[model samples]
Target chain A: MLEIKGLKAKVEGKEILHGIDLAVPAGEVHAIMGPNGSGKSTLGYVLAGREGYEVTDGQALFKGRDILALEPEERAAAGLFLAFQYPVELPGVTNATFLKSALNAVRKARGEGELDAMQFLKRVRGIMKSLGMAEDMLKRGVNVGFSGGEKKRNEILQMAVLEPRLAVLDETDSGLDIDAMRIVADGVNALRGPGRAMLVITHYQRLLDYIVPDRVHVLMGGRIVRSGGPELARELEQKGYGSLPAAA
Target chain B: MARTAQTSRVTAPAPALAAQLARYAGLKDRLAGAGLPWLRDLREAAAQALAANGLPTPRTEAWRFTNLRPLHDLSFAEPVALVGSEAERAALALLPALGRWRAVLVDGRFRADLSELDGLPEGLAVQPLASALHAGAAGLDGLLGTLARPDQEPMAALNTALMEDGVIVRVAPGVKVAERLEVVSIASAPAERAIAFHPRLLVTLGADASLILVDTALGAGAAAYLNNPVAEVDLAPGASLDHVRVQDEGPAALHLATVYARVAERARYESFTLSLGARLARNEVHVTLAGADGDCSVHGAYLAHGQRHIDNTSIIRHAAPACRSRQVYKGVLKDQSHGVFQGKIEVDQIAQKTDGYQMNQAILLSPEAEVNSKPQLEIYADDVKCSHGATVGELDEAQLFYLRSRGVPAEEARAILVQAFFGDALEQVPDEGLREALSALIAGWWEREGGAG
Candidate 1:
């Protein structure tokens, strides 16, 4: 379960998220829909504990614990994951090496035994096969020359491998084609269970069609002005975000 | 007293140059092949040049970023013959044994007892430089001191003036050396005194011959010493040579090395220097593509920490048409260490259609760590394709955050990124085993200097 009470944040001198309150309970998925520059991505980043985004006020609670004061790694160790909109390219680090280091670090922090090379390889290969990724992708540098679709797929693969309790999907479908969106959706759908939760951030209603969020919230003017069930996405798609309530 | 002082000041070179002159003056009688007229003349000329130029000061154009004042102040004694001990042999065992053909040089003198030269294929000759000189080897007529000129390199000039012993390797025309050749140079100076030795290596690969050379220089114990080595390589038409040099001297050691190479038509030459030791070290390489279609690549990686100063300077000349050259140098500095990379590529008028590329990158892990990178390109041919770039920066914060977000600790994340930064340059090594050995060496260095910093 995740809770954000009056999540007000700012980048530089400008305020982005202005006192927004939202919550997604266990075993459910939520979608935050907004127009451009509506601070949808800011919510995802602020929850992931990224630096430079000053949380002017409010606290983010995951599993009844405040994560705002933890470092990014500590938050990650506490079962939080952020699928970046744009994955950074690591020039000389192979994807396999990066994943192994990350998995082991998280496992160690959680007081669990680390996987050996063979065990790790077997598990990774299985997940990669299910995701329809070629084995060579693991051998290449991390996202150095990956295509848009491949990057999204790689991010999904990482999410599946890490298995965080609360996953934040930040515009995962922005640059993807329809087929890529379907594949990413299928990957996310495969990971859905009673013990996990997801917050999907998107600018359009097309992604909601694949993931089918349990609830939809319309974020406008740095606040969530509307909240409804799945039917709200269809209504917004038909009428557009221009019909949202004015800011307080 | 004033008249005497004036006379001495007028006659004497600068203090540093005077010290070097005095050292070389005392070393003249002990130099190898002193009876040989040509060798004597070479030493005399070099001594005069060294006295004229003195050691390169901070004001010198080539050494502006590197100060030799520390090297100038030390008084280096002539290297004495080292009697191999159990400790020395034990120390040598720590080096990576990657090659089959191995030669060991203790204190710059070839150690036949420690060498393994049997089973060499026909048309291949490997022997000590002193033996080759004394025996009047047939190829010695015009090979020694040909590529490295004293006027161009003063430290090389100093090396020439006091040269002692080294190795001579020759591969006949059309002969392919199947096994890699290993040359291990170990310096074990006395604890109280600083010793200096010049080791010269001449490698001549005949037409159509192929060879791989791995040269490792290390010091034993905690003694202070100077290991000055000059390696000259001549690759004939259609020949190829892969050279890997690792300098892992002692903490109190000073290492100055120069490599001169002449690549012939359709020949290929590749070299990589891994610098990880010495209080102060400079590895200079000069390569010339003498014939058309020649290809040459020079790459290096340097790690400096704890007041260490490491410099990698290279000059590549494209003298023939349709030649290609590449240079990539990377460095990581920490804890008040300094790293310098100066690479110059020259394309002559006759070398039309020449393609040249050079890149230098550095990562400073500490606030006091410094790096100076200079890349120069001189093209007389208008049609040549040449590009050069240099970058100095701290570790990428975004990359660090990404790695850390994955649960990697701050120190582990930094070590991984630093290794990756050097991976681009290390991949240039042609041999996989040697490359892996060097990579492991870099990892060990990171564990010591990179993790905490």
Candidate 2:
């Protein structure tokens, strides 16, 4: 479960998310559709506890706890995952090692025994196969020379492995081809369960066709202007957000 | 001389002062009586220049970065004569078995009993400089005196004035020695804390002949000993040679060496220097590509910690047309230790098509640790590619956070990055065993300095 009440966030001294309220219970996929300059990415980053995002007002609660005070790593350990719109390239560090370390860190923080290297490799290799990622990607430096689509796909692979309680995919399908988009959506859908929630943030409705969100919200100027059922996504896909009625 | 007078009433050149003056005085009279007239004049000039310049002071330009106050602390006179033991002889036997033609300098004296010459090829001769000096090889005096300026550097001058016995390897025209020439320089006990060694080597490879020179220096005990060494290498037209120098003296020892080399037309020379020793150690190497199509590659690595001061300075000159030179030096300084790398690549006007690159990088784990790196390039040629880069900094915080975020402890992450930092330096080492040994030594130094992974 996730909740945001009166969330007013400013980046670089300019307010972006102004007075927003939202809630998502378990076992549901919520799509946040917004036009350019709509603060959708800002919301995702703020939820992940990125630095320099001044939370001037409001509190974000994840799993009934204030998530605003946690560091980025602490938030990750607390079962909150943010698939970045663009992943940072880390040279000289293999993806397999990076993922295993992340997994063990979270496990250790949660009072679980650390997985051995063999155990980690077996499990992560299986996840990679299911996500349609090549085994070679595990050996190279993390996203050093990855294609745009490969980077997005790598993000999805991380989401599946981490298996956080709330997974927020920020524009994961933007630079991806149809096949990559489908693979990414399938990877996200594989984690759908009764105890987990998903927030699919996107600019276009094409990705939603495969992931199939249960609820849709139109975010404008850092606030959710409209909320409706799944048909709202299809409605906006056809008629576009320009013809939508003004918020009351 | 300075330390003895300052600490105690006893002056320097105490126990051996009379013998010291007697040894050089006798040698000077003998050279004056016999040998080439020109070489006799050169030796006298070198001695006179040394008496004037004296031991290097911190004020000297070449010794600016390195302070010799510790060296001046103890007065050094001629060491009492020391003989080799059976254990020392046996230990000298297992020396990597470099070549059929081998030369041994024990306590600065040439030891024929510990040398091997069964597999030596013809047209190549490995003999003692003492014999070569008496023979018609006065050309060595010319090469040594001209290649390195002794008056300019006191240590080099000291080595020249107090010169002892070492090997002189000469490869004749079109003669390629299939085996390597191993020169093991050992310092004995009586020479322990009191003596200074000036072990000199001269290696000349004739046209089209190839040779390999392996030099290793070993010291005894915790006493203060100084090994001031100088080597001159000459490569003729179309000749090739590989030189590997390893200095691993004892803890309280002071090792200093300078190598001057010349590569002729279409000749190639590759040299590497690895230093892991002494309280204060400095190795200087200057090389020149003297003719067309000459190529030179020089590399060095020094790992020091725990108050050790190591300086490696190299100058590679491209003096001929169509010559190329490459220099790569890397170091790791931990604790309160200091490491210095001052490398220069000079290209003259005739040296067109010259390509030179030099890079020096260091990882400072502690704020107290220091690394002074100056990579300089002086070019007078119009058509050339020359670039120099020097970087001195700590590890990247972002990479560190990324590693720690992955569940690797902070210590383990730092070790991994440090290993990668010195990876290129070790990779350049040609010998696997030596490379592994150096890597292990570096790792041990890191851990000893409280770097736990």
Candidate 3:
């Protein structure tokens, strides 16, 4: 569903992600574990077409189409989602409006009919109920004054509502407690199906226990040094990245 | 003029101001209520004060950052020369259709044909200034020239000297007006010539009375005319008045509006200004909390695009003990437009336990867009709570990216952010329908301006 080869990205005129190569098939979940300042978040940002994350030499393809050439909104219309680690607060825009616009934009891009107010409310209410989010959350400003756990959960709610074919979770569990992390994981796990792919980026292994990944890749020094299965996450959690042998 | 630097030193009036005085001299005899000795003395007094202090300019202390050179470049046709055609009148009748009691003024002339004052309630009265200026008009004893000081505000003095016609709104004591009252003023000029008009609005609420006033200023054509209005509002004890000012003129029009409000004991004066259109405009509001426990809120949002210049200047004075005042203003400037906000809160010596807050913020959408924000607080009472803040900034990049990544188009995202920036001030509108109307107007402006492009 997603492929990246020779993905060399730079931020502020300095190269961050050097020669990254990865592929995730449909219906699969891939986890990238790295220490602090390991270019994991940079990879997510670069793929999401965020400004200032310059790509010197790379091409990221989603569903066999080059996504590096698209704008951030255009990339989202092409079924790409990036769940931010620290979601910015929109002071006056209600979450319902934001979600409706996003959902309609994506649906329009996919040649599907847009959801009216009643249909949108029904679909969103069902999803929010499953995610255990308060119904009034739709009335409040987008991420304004939301707790850390609530923010992460809000991100998941958006992912569920938009139903992106591929979602890039950028450190979604950074500030979440055990219960919150499980809720986010459950939300993500519910979206897993044969037509969707997810790239989960995290610094710790606790989140992996809930939404167990199909493959694990160790990102260190701006390169993927090792690739293995679910046990690799536990192994690194026990031994730590410092003791792991480099296999790049 | 609470925060204005007046009376300490004097400078010669500007050429533009002198020319206006000359125009006033030419039209003094034709002014309203000329035969009335009190009105004549009041006009002369204001004219003398205006000659001394002159009109505000870019060089004026508090009037810096706004250029009035455009006013000097155009010759103004007097209000008497302007005659609206049936087509023009028809076009204007569609303006104040908010489904309430409305009074429409075309170039300072009260249009009884277009006004919706038939089914007014018993305690409420709306009349033309001509009627109020006629003989046997007993209500204009102290309410006409009391609040709006001609000596302090030159534009108001100009209005006082040349005031032709406007609406006089009054509510009886202990009467509550359940419906909102609207006064709409439209400016137009003869072919190929710019025009200027000065209208006076008198509002007085008796003890325990309450009313909502929507005062709107709009233009007719693309002529570079000037719409200057002076409003005097007197609120008795325990009275409440909500004043909403909407200034949306033509592209080449200049709108200068002044409002003076006096709040008595336990009374409240709440004003929300939405300055959307004009070539060069300034909306100045002065409020005095006269009696104890009176409160006032001066809040607004100014949207300037397409090289337009808009200014919002206000001064709120706390005269009695335990009065409260708050000023909140936000502005958005795009293209090469400019915006200015100067708000001051003053607490007098005997006004102990006074609580005041002021905030001014602006967002510049382009590199060439400019903003000048000044928030001032002067306190003489020791036991008072007062604070002020100002901010001038561009949109946050991270916020934009966050919105764009959520599938909103770039322009839609920018419009949303700008509207959000203006939300704090718009929330001050006390009525829900009026608030929604203002928000819809802002959205229309955004779309008209090509949505942040």
* TM-score winner: 3
Write one digit per residue (lDDT tens) for candidate 2, span A164-190: 899988988898999989888888989
Off by over 4 Å in 1: A246-248, B1-11, B136-138
Residue B164 lDDT (model 1): 77
Model 1, B1-453: lDDT tens digits are 999999987677777677778877887876668777788888899998888777788878988888887777788876665677775687678877868888889888999988988998898888899877666545676788888888878889988888878999999999998889999998886787898888999999999999989999988867778898999999999999999999999898889899999999999999999999999999999999999999999999999999999999999999999999999999999889999999999999999999999998998888999988888989899889999999999999889888877778888899899989988798899888888999999999888777674
Docking class of 1: medium
Q: List-wise, what DockQ does each model earn?
A: 0.74, 0.19, 0.82
Q: DockQ (C-alpha) of model 1?
A: 0.74
**Cα-based TM-score, every candidate:** 0.95, 0.71, 0.96
Candidates arranged by DockQ, highest first:
3, 1, 2
List clashing residue pairs in candidate 3. Answer: none
How many backbone collisions does model 3 have? Answer: 0
TM-score of chain A of 1: 0.98
Q: Which runs of model 2 end up more than 4 angstroms from their true locations?
A: A1-146, A149-248, B1-43, B77-146, B169-195, B211-224, B244-252, B275-277, B426-441, B450-453
lDDT of 2 by residue, B1-453 (tens): 887668663334422333434456676655322466666665566666666655566676667778876676765655555555764565565445544466778766677777676556787878787666767665565564567667666667666666756677889989976666778887653433467778788888999999777788876555777788888888999998888777777677788888888999999888877777778889888899999999888887777777888988889899988887877877777678888888898999989988888887776767888988877889899999988888878787656654543345567567656655665677766656556755675566556653731
Compose the digit string of candidate 1's lDDT tens values, residues A94-137: 99999999999999999999999998999899889888899999
Assess each prediction's global lDDT (C-alpha) against the native.
0.89, 0.77, 0.88
